[model samples]
Target: PDRIEILLGVGSMTVPRSSVEKVEMASPEQNRAIRNQWKTRYLLHEDYVPAGMENIARLLTAARDARDTARQAGSAHAADMKHESSLLARLERLRSELIRVSKRMQNASRTSSPAAYNAMVLEYNNLYAAYTVGIHELAEFRAKHPAPSDRFSFYLDSLDALRRAYESALVLPDSGQDADRARFLDRVARIIEDYSRDFSTTAVRSEHSESGIIVAVTVNDSTTGRFLLDTGAAVMTLTEQFARRLNLDTSSLPAIDIVLADGAQASARAVILPSVQVGSARCEHVEAAVIAQQPAPDIDGLLGMSFLRNFAFRIDPSSGQVTLTQFAPR
Candidate 1:
């Protein structure tokens, strides 16, 4: 057979043999092993299109088409412009609903009964499908209308909202629900890829050493040095030598308490850096701490949340690269 048909609770889906990555016996042990091996590729019955999804898809498409027509009509057509505004508002409502339903679905997957979980899954699939349609429409709209416009920012806001929703969905418990986890990861990866392609992002090459992963960081647009990538650290931290090298007035800066990786508490001066740049991804008015001693002989400081929190960042060990995309709040 050139294709395979997967039976689902609601229906079934057929896929070409070329699209099928692997095949395993439908046994619990085999399923677990396959899930472990391919965490992000496994699919489940719940991943299929649920009943009533076709209608939802049609509704979303119609709404998007109507909005596109209204937008194309321009301001001369007052009624069509009003219709477009209405459709935009409806799409925004749909996005909000999708977020709310996904949160509930997350809870259901964790603690609900089988029947209750199934019900939530159906509702979630419908909303998620509609939300995806809305995202495509927004992407198309943005393509037609470039940046520096209010509408462009609005579309970006919608995309950011979807990204956050996907992130929240990724917070599932370790309950052997590999399919759901994989689905969320696949969506998050797509969103991250889309962000990299559509928006300004920075990828900085990192050095992995015994101490930790290190990347070059520029402080106040002047002092450039290597810093340990420490997500656990509360704020950007610099050794006294590096701080003085930057000509920072540490003497007048306020002091704060910080805990070292060794679980020792120490006092450090707090400094507000005018800017911190990791590759091209920059954050201004970053808070940092100036410690008396350097963390490592070659490392100047710790790149902490103060800098990283400004962006959605991913550290890839295999590639030894840190990808940073500006986090836009909805």
Candidate 2:
């Protein structure tokens, strides 16, 4: 992942947006890949977010702001000592003291022991965040212009009860395995109520065989072209012969270092493909790697989740009607 990040940063990148120009209706197989990709992205936005997450975010932001203000204020301590008068000199000393204090605050913002402090205070801040959110509901219940709705009052009571439950859940008799499991379950419930399930699992599929990545050949690479379906791979990868068919400058692709599961490393040049058609699916402007001179198998290329997540997916060995959308990504 680190090596890929470097390549993405330094490699001569093609304008990925315009890589693929050819477009056509997806065959039955391609549609499945495209459909799954769409579902993955949709699930990301709708299902991955947490409950009361906004309040926690606000608390974290406030802590960060306080920390930043302390650091900036501390920077002036050196200049404070340079003052001509004794009183000014004293003020500078105070500035230096404030800098140290601000640093402590910055640490608290990080909540990483030295990076932060006052765990009890941090807990209170989190509590206040929840309280503030609940107050909105409380205020809505007692508005004078509105007729008192018993239902709204009940909602306020329910919100307060939830807050009490949250507070109680924070207390545990001991940090045993059972307690740990309960905490985990509580967090999951909170996530389900606040955020969606998609965040817990993204649309990444990894298949590790004794050989390596699970590459399924839908079409064997021919003198003309071929396609491979790969859900386990993280990125779309293609061979040099197929890339040459698109007329792109493969030389611009940087030689990347990739570590396989078995600690084996490989060097390969990366390129953005115009498009790839696998089974009934097609991906436009997909990023792929053109491996160095090697006898590769499993079709001409493998279409990974980056292309697969652009559409919904379903697999049935009986019918083999894989489908995908080759248009704008999900």
Candidate 3:
């Protein structure tokens, strides 16, 4: 039997190659090709985002570069900054107009007014072009300017919000999805909040792969071992061997039923951890389960939402940093 080794987030496992159906290798060229395809589909589609909007986008970029250069060289005036601000204001107005036109389009469809619907489509197309220009401008700006270490925590938070806003704008074909559009707008409102907070903290490096992130997690505030960060999992889980190695009292806990990823059923014991810490984020009274076996031998446990949901986190696969920040509730 040929043994095949696979790397988990924190550990490695060897399995029979005969048991596996197929395997694919990841390469830089493959990644670049995928990125190019997505860019053409979403960002460079002429039918979706008009040619005129691209001109506005170029102008906005020029204005931003000029303002930034002036500020960096200590020659920037109020008017230099105001130039970009004015363009932003105009973009916001266009977004609002697009929303209004979309609503009319939705209504016109219900009334079967072909002429009215066509007119609304024309208006939406025009407004969408302008909105696309603004979205791309801000996105490029953020990507070019990495937040300094002092502001990195909140910068990561705001970046996520901005990305969501841009994605929502791109997918919103017309105003029919008003609720979705409104949600994006609300997230955009929080971008400023993300910028206002300056929480300073150290980031933890993690071993990651295409499967997920694997990091050393501290259990009960003392013992540390390799654990997989699985946000989709409802609760934490530990293999029986790993739990025993840590000297945990698995027998004292109540038994609970768990469904495995392969649709198999298993039993485990529910245990409470006084403290569980991953990177800089920590939680107390965390619920966990101890199982007889895991798919891999080296992985001690699975870190679930109980520990992750408490903090705002960003996983940078390229950098291998899992940045976590305590967020203020909305």
Question: RMSD in angstroms, all models?
Answer: 26.5, 34.5, 32.2
- Candidate 1 vs candidate 2: the lDDT winner is 1
Off by over 4 Å in 2: 1-224, 260-263, 278-282, 293-298, 325-330
Residue by residue across 1-330, what tens digits does model 3's lDDT show? 599897632235799998989867647787667544543454333222332234333433343344334334322323343554565566556645765776667567735677777777777777766565664564354344422222333344444444454444555566454543444344434543443343324479898755568888988777898888887776788888778877775452336687765668789865556688876677665657789877455788788765765556778878998876753222
Q: Can you tell me which runs of candidate 1 are displaced by over 4 Å?
A: 1-198, 328-330
Q: Model 1 — TM-score against the truth?
A: 0.44
Taken over the whole model, the C-alpha lDDT of each candidate is 0.65, 0.42, 0.60
**What would the per-residue lDDT of candidate 2 be over residues 180-218, giving only the tens digit for each residue?**
334343653464344221111122232343333333433
Q: Model 1 over residues 215-262: C-alpha lDDT tens digits?
A: 999999999999999989868899988988898755533356889888
Off by over 4 Å in 3: 1-202, 328-330
**TM-scores, in order shown?**
0.44, 0.30, 0.41
Report how far residue 259 has shifted in candidate 1, in Å.
1.2
